[model samples]
Target: MEAEFKDAEIFKRMMDATGNLMSDVSIDFNEEGFAIKAMDPANIAMVLFEAKNSIFSSFNIEKPIKISVSLDDLNGILKLVKKDDKLKISDSKNKLVLDIRGKTKQHFTIPLIDENYTAQKIPQLKFTAEVTVLSSLVKDSVKAAALVDDSIYFTVDMPRLIISSKSEEKEFSQDLSINDNKEIFDMKSESTTRSKYSIEYLTKFLYSADSEKPIKLSFSNNYPLKLDYEINSDAKMSFILANRLE
Candidate 1:
């Protein structure tokens, strides 16, 4: 298997996002693209990541392969990538080879993990509400809620999506509506729905998000929250956080 990316930025960002929850991942490379589905140790959250072969500058794979690798080691090597640096990846026996090319050339090899990982199945959740809004709005709401409470509430009331949190006397709330806020691109709900989620998880999930792009959120009352972040047309990430019981 051999693949070359024009830049390592997206790969680095992906590792950064998933590393918050998992120490390692088993990535599946096929003729179509690459995919990974992993759940955090606590089992409170799951991350689904996919990148199409089209996203790579060059991609070649004779047969399907699943390689498990330590995120720490991979992230360490990716950190060395300078701006606009190209990354070449290949596998040799039990080792994964990474080549960085920019002002200078560098090569690093890390052993592939020998452990086996069962692919996580994504939950088929029926959400009553769905909203699409600028990532910056979600980031700001999470940040504000973090300052006051450990858990945040997402309430869908008609055309408005309300994010709020409360800790004793301290509280934070941000109201976003498709009719009033340009940041809220769309909102739909069959009925009023509200769900609470961990602020810590939400914060980490949005940490690497592109604030300029819109994020899709889906949830039902007391149901898990699914947040979808699109890096591009070919690269996308989806995070699911179990609702915190009141």
Candidate 2:
């Protein structure tokens, strides 16, 4: 498959979402769009990447393809790309070729071999409430929870959302109002459902919050928390983080 992006920087930003979570990733390119899915090392979390059409700034896919490679290696390869460089990826003789062209032209080769990687199956989640909040605020709440405990509690009400964490040492809580046009949009809470989640996993999951858009959250009592961020018309990325209830 042959694909090109106007600038390599955009591609770099997209790949950063994976971080060091998965050693192998499956990239699916089809007439619909480009999609990727991988589970974190511990299988407690998942990262999904997708981009469609011009929504990628510049994108073109000649044919459909699927390839698996180490996420860390792919990230290292993208680091070599410079600004304003056009990126071209192609599969040749079981190897992936990465070409970058702009003020400087560079080409790198990554050997591809079959690996025993099973794609993660996303489960159907029946969430009690769905809340839309500012990505920055969510990130800040997770940061605060980090200082108090490993697990953070999320509780939602109709007009307000609360995030709190407490330990033998101290407690931290942040309240956000839905009346103001701050970040929260519509919140529906039932029976005051609350769950605790690992702060470390939650922090890594918010790495893509720089988009300035609201992050959609869905949770149920004692179930996994779903965090979704839409990139554009083409695709939406989501994470399923398991909860650690107290």
Which has the greatest TM-score?
1
Q: After superposing candidate 2, which stretches have Cα over 4 Å from the reference? A: 55-63
**Per-residue lDDT for 158-243 in model 2, tens only?**
67788999999899998877887467867887767777898888887788556477898899887889998875545577888888
The reply for model 1, stretches above 4 Å from the true place, is none
Clashing pairs in 2: none
Using all chains and alpha carbons, the TM-scores for the candidates as numbered come to 0.97, 0.90
Cα-lDDT of candidate 1: 0.91
lDDT of 2 at 35: 79
Whole-model Cα lDDT of every candidate shown, in order: 0.91, 0.77
Indicate which candidate wins on lDDT.
1
Candidate 1 lDDT over 1-246, as tens digits, reads 999986578888888998888899888899998988888988999999999998789998999998889999999998999898899999989999999999999999999997565678889999999999999989888888989999999999998889999999898998877798999988999999999999999988998899999999999999999999888888899999999998
Instruction: For candidate 1, list the clashing residue pairs, or say none.
Output: none
